[model samples]
Target: MTAAASDINFCFPVRELESERVKLTPFIPDLHADLYFQGSAAYPELYDFIPWEAFTDTSDFVKKVIEGCVRPDTGIALYAVIDKTPTGTNPSKPTSANFAGIMGYTNTSPANLSTEISYALILPPFQRTHVTTNAIGLLLQYALDSPPHGLGLRRVQWKANRLNTKSINAVQRLGFKLEAILRYDRIFVGSKTNAANGERERAGDPRPGTVGTDTALLALCWDDWESERARVLQAMDRRS
Candidate 1:
């Protein structure tokens, strides 16, 4: 039997994380999947760097994203990035929620006290806005701040496709330093020739006809948080 949405545990406490500009809450498929599918379908091209193709429907999102990347056993947490800033189009509804995107913590390790932030999908309408900055900033706080304030994780890692300059830029701006370039980081089954928006894998490889990618790994450690946290807040405060 399928467990109830609220009953599902992510191996970490699911809390409502927010800032003046953005809010991130646990993503419950029963409620947000349809909305996510509608938004994602409109901008399939946005998933150019993702290992898998754009979702065909809500069911596909649940089957692939939920079943694949978001595993409770693995301690992954998916969040709904909600825009909270007052839109000029609807000035009267200052607190209205506008669904912006999605983000997640993957490869979370409670014992090791680390996690990786991955799968950020900012909808077209919300791109290049404060949503991205505050959304990411909020997660950083939740993950790195000391107990009673936040999770106090020792490290937060971000892995982006080497070709994804925008993502690389975002993480760098948030104070993550480049550690290494992970070659052949992931395999996109059936891609056969190209590596999901990245360079093609080397030819004559043992696993022939497999699409792969090189990952640019960047990390923000507890040692850097005190200073970077201040920088992140200033960036999130900017209006664009």
Candidate 2:
């Protein structure tokens, strides 16, 4: 459908999205512990471009997930990424799924029939595996599906730090095209220690020499998805 003809009141339903390797379910307080464990384990590596550090406990993690990530009023829907493979020592026996990470959609603009996918965080074990690939494939399929099946959005965007080559490569491999770079897009303040001067500064001190991050914008519009859907789906299935 054309962007103008698409429903302006389109709302993303909170539900589960599954692929061969991963399952995405609506975020809940009950899953906070598992989310915290996985996210905290990844720690500073995952936080390099994510703009947030690992949580100290379930309470801290749940508060951020509720207040920051899954704000329904703002049209953001967060999901817990669960690993579908067997986790216990018994490979032949089924085991409870483990929380691998989190991902979701934000910056939704129904009037424009567009939304940006953001806040994807997968643990070390799942990185470079087919889990993320399949998760994104599932999301794309749902976002682009026609009425009675999905939202049929005209545009789906992906943004990342310009210096984050890993993230950029991941999305590009998924068929998103690089659009532009937003210069000095976000400011991040933190403590600095001067070895020569033996001086220490606390976070948010607002001192000089602080640098901000530039955002690299990428997108998969309806036309792009239509043209590339088959190939992308084939790649996902092949990799699965």
Candidate 3:
């Protein structure tokens, strides 16, 4: 049986956001977990900036990421990215290569009308292509476009490991402004497989890994959307 979004207890209304270039659907573990795992297993470097590793197997992925982290109850909802832009220049139709990558919302707060774009991982084949730009632009539009077309959220944020220059640059390119740096953001449990590197835990500390990591915080408030939307679209339109 193909599992539904509810299987992971997704919090939102479960809308599929898309564009001429990409599609973002609620991630269903039973259907997507295996594909995501297989693709990522061969590319561990892709996860170097996150808190978790490339997952040993499908079961490990389902148990740790799907069940443990990205659940409605946990305030994190994931989506699967699908590439629709046919191969070739200036393609005008949908070819949908399937499973381009993954992205999600974290720390969502309807009351405050805020959310953070997190867990973005574009597979090796799709990186540096239209998939990333369109996927992010769709999410921005969905979160900031106001009622009748979007969640009308007041704010959307992007967080990354402070040491991840690539990630920091990517989000900033998408319209999020660097707000501040969070000191001692998280503990790496003395392991650096997922993060850039780490400093030893302080004296008398027991964690045994990097004492903690610094986080780069960035955001795009609703006020910035009117201008950023057009700018983001312009970026998506670039052929190069």
lDDT by candidate, in order shown = 0.78, 0.68, 0.78
Residue-level lDDT tens digits of model 1 in 20-88:
777787777776777788887878677677766787889998888876657544578888777876455
What TM-score would candidate 1 get against the native? 0.87
The sequence of per-residue lDDT tens digits that candidate 3 reaches over residues 1-240 is 233736646555657786776778778776677878877888988866676766889999989977777763656778887777655632222123467778988888888889988889989899888888888888898889988898899999998889888878987887789999898787665357446335655687765545477899999999999888899988877788
CA deviation > 4 Å runs, candidate 3: 1-5, 72-74, 86-97, 193-200
Please give the TM-score that candidate 3 achieves against the real structure: 0.88
Q: Give the TM-score of each candidate.
A: 0.87, 0.80, 0.88
Score residue 108 of candidate 1 by CA lDDT.
Answer: 86
Query: Relative to the unseen true structure, what is the C-alpha lDDT of residue 4 in candidate 1, on a scale of 0 to 100?
Result: 56
Q: Using TM-score, rank the candidates from best to worst.
A: 3, 1, 2
Which regions of candidate 2 fall more than 4 Å away from where they truly are?
A: 1-10, 87-97, 191-210
Better candidate by lDDT, 1 or 2: 1
Per-candidate total of colliding backbone pairs: 0, 0, 1
Among the numbered candidates, top TM-score falls to 3
